[model samples]
Target: MIERRMNPHEGRSVINNGVKLRGSGFCIHMFYIRPVTYRGRIDKGQKIGEMLPMQRVYPGITSHVHVQNCNRFNVTRYL
Candidate 1:
């Protein structure tokens, strides 16, 4: 798949995520599930999905993640 990421600096880059999309230009991100909560507690996989944010949180810092999705999509991963 053709995916683009527009950084805060107004810079953009395209990448291939192995999805089948031809000539489709758009921005994208690869999201996944973790086994913990924002407060650093282990959470059950079955119940964690209900608490994750539906929107993308771009944490500029690499030390920790602080983004929260406002919607309850019950999604475990996204890209």
Candidate 2:
């Protein structure tokens, strides 16, 4: 099932998803989509670089966070 953009621009760019991000002290719009393949749609979970997966696409007003803790004590133990 190939998902074509309603209004594709600059190739894969579609309409602004109502989300705005400020980068380098400037506001910019963002859009994500999957590419059509020779047979049909792309892989299910395979990410093609910076493009976001449709199944895991994030919307505005949503909050996401991640925390990583390195608790490797005695590194030589596993060596």
Best of the candidates, TM-score = 2
Local lDDT at 59 for model 2: 53
Error of 2 at 49 (Å): 5.2
Q: Candidate 1 on 1-79: residue-level lDDT in tens?
A: 2222112122231111111111233222222323223222222343321222323344452323223232334446763
lDDT of 2 by residue, 1-79 (tens): 2222222234433331222223343333234423232123345574422443344434553332211112323445535
lDDT for 33 (candidate 1):
29
Q: Count the backbone clashes (under 3 Å) in each candidate.
A: 3, 0
Error of 1 at 45 (Å): 32
